[model samples]
Target: MEKKVFLLPFASVILLLHYWVTCLTLAVSLTNLSDEYALLALKAHITYDSQGILATNWSSTTSYCNWFGVSCNAHHGRLTALNLSNMGLEGTIPPQVSNLSFLASLDLSDNYFHASLPNEIGNCRQLRQLYFFNNELTGSIPQSLGNLSKLEESYLDSNHLTGDIPEEMSNLLSLKILSLFVNNLTGSIPSGIFNISSLQSISLSANDLYGNLPMDMCDRIPNLNGLYLSYNQLSGQIPTSLHNCAKLQLISLSYNEFIGSIPKGIGNLSELEVLYLGQKHLTGEIPEALFNISSLRIFDLPSNNLSGTLPSSMCCNLPSLEVISLSWNQLKGKIPSSLSHCQELRTLSLSFNQFTGSIPLGIGNLSKLEELYLGINNLTEYGSEGIVSTSDVYSNGIMLLEVFARKKPTDEMFVGDPTLKSWVESLASTVMEFVDTNLLDKEDEHFAIKENCVLCIMALALECTAESPEDRINMRDVVARLKKIRIKLLM
Candidate 1:
């Protein structure tokens, strides 16, 4: 009886061991066999496969492990990767793709696939990377995608995807890159998604998203390096906590309705490279703190209501600045002379403002100055004389020399003698010849006299430059003479 009982327990242990081994064997061979059907289903769903790689290489006759874009684990014989990016394939992604139970990576980027990402995608429990950016995929991102507990990266940008980002996305604790920019997404950003500690990059620009940016931004996403949320309806003050994102390099929140002063300590962000915050409802003086960020490359804050004087020491402070555009603001005060410190300043436009005072004379010293806009302002010197300024004129000399330079569009040889006086004086002998031949016909009247346009124009020039100011012809006489000249030319 004791031996029989012992044999029963031993047999139970052996059966348990056999079950585990059989399941292990099934797992090893299951991936390739299941992936063959999955790949075939994918081929069947493809309405347009411009390249016949799937038709040619993926077949029942060949091993599924040998198919193009299909990568398998040599040791386990499991389908671990599928990359059909830029393959010119067009069609819906079949739910059957999830049958590749051991798949780790799936890339259908830069293709024409147009349908909701299948909820079955979550079945690929080991999936670490999902690349479907630059496709025509529509409909909401499946909530089931949150079931991918192991997912590390997701790219769904440049698509037609709509609806709120699923709150279930917060389940992805390992997510590092979440890019869904340039989509048709609406609604406020899901605050829970920001809690993902491992996230390094988040791009949701060019969407219809609205609402105040969460004030606890840095606390939630401390590991972020790039945060692009531009071209949305975001309003309210830029959160002060943003400065705490010590590793942040690129911040683009432009084209929004954000109001109030820019965060005070933003300049303390030492790693910042590109800060684009244009077309917002922001106000206040240009912060001196901003100029101190030595790592700044492109600082754009145009089309705002920001006012006040720029710090005079900016040239010495901002050494890395390359592009700065502060146009269409209510800013006033002198353009700082120290701007020459930014030797690398490639583009500096400060147009359409109330900036008074002379442009800093030192600006001309910037050897690399490419664009300078300083118009529509009260910078020109004025006095009690309500007239525009001009060069000084002598009493008897009517400034004939400078006047001549303004007329003819000729070279240096014609510099001194381009006036109407010189033109007529050179042809004075021709007048006598015409009179003698009666070519200056009395019966011809105006046409005959008008034909002597050069002579009349010169006569008027001589009259205007007479030795006595009183003898100088009035501007009306010159106009009449010009009319006669035109009449003669037309005749």
Candidate 2:
């Protein structure tokens, strides 16, 4: 019995020693991944305890799974993801992140992270989604990213990243969404980057990328739905091959150096809702096929050399259009009355053109219209007898009259002759009668004009008629009197 007791004690000692050795090994391995230099930089932005550790009560040695912004597999006790978005973290990405060999996702967006991406990131071979957008990150994209063969989505936009996009990224054959827009990237886009059959969305806008776009861009990426290449230096015509991209939903190639007539086959993109090709060198008449795209919601082609009359049946078929801008083009003809059928219209700008005829009365029926710009055009009003003249019922309202009078002298029909002093006396009597009867009633006793009201009114009348017969005060004298009275009471 004594021998058995000794063996039991000996076995307990051996087990305790084994446990200690295993714990020591784990601590040493974790120390290599701690990245002390980066940890110090992070500590500079945080308050630390007396032990020179971050001022947090969590135990880091027990299990990093319970650490902030970390998730792990319960069975394997391995870290799988780290989401530290919008955490206000300021510093360079630490190389120690390479220790998380099984990490599948990492999100550090909307923070102040700076400097080049750590080369050690290539160690996360299992990573699928990497988000580092909206940061102060600099330096060229690390070519080692090709190690992530399984990456599906990568967003590094809105950063200061410069130099050519690494050609090595073409290795990520499984990539679906890649957004590197709003960066300082230069050089021609890597050919065949879109050759990946799985690509669904790609946004490289607001960059300095030059050279013709890939001819097979749309054909190779069959699943691509959104492609934004605006604000670049890309030249050459839009590839006609893009018509094959049946699933394309949004395409913006605005503010580029592209030249050629817009492809008529654009109508083939039945799923397209937003198409912005404005501020490019594209010429020729807008394709009638474009008007037939029933799914179009935003069609912006402003500041182009497009000419010819707009198709009257344009908006007649597009009931989903909300914003349409064809301004600063050479388009002629009258505004389409059928545009009123677009009940969802919010903004319509067709300014700086040679369009003639009356403004469509149907335009007033567009209840959702908020902004309408028809300036610098030859739009004349039609009379009731179908004669082309400026005589519509709502033609000359107070606002329009003021704007016109400010620009040029008013006509005698609008403002009476001022050459004859007798004409002035007759105008003053008529104006006084209108004011006394309609304005100065007993109900207005509480709202009396100031003591200088009469002098101000007479001065205004004299100054208004001193120019010429066509510059005299007509019925505007009454409006002036009413306005002066309101101003005096407010003062």
Predicted structure with the largest lDDT when compared to the true one? 1
lDDT by residue (181-262, candidate 1, tens digit) is 9999999888888789899999999999998877888888888999888888888878888887889999888888899988
Each prediction's TM-score versus the true structure:
0.71, 0.70
Total backbone collisions for each predicted model: 0, 0
For candidate 2, the 10 contiguous residues with the lowest summed lDDT are 404-413
- Over the stretch 335-400, how does candidate 2's per-residue lDDT look in tens digits? 887888899997776766788987887776788975455656787744432432212211222112
Alpha carbon lDDT of each predicted model: 0.75, 0.71
Candidate 1, residue 485: how far the Cα is off, in Å = 28
lDDT of 1 at 213: 79
Where does candidate 2 stray beyond 4 Å?
Answer: 1-62, 382-491
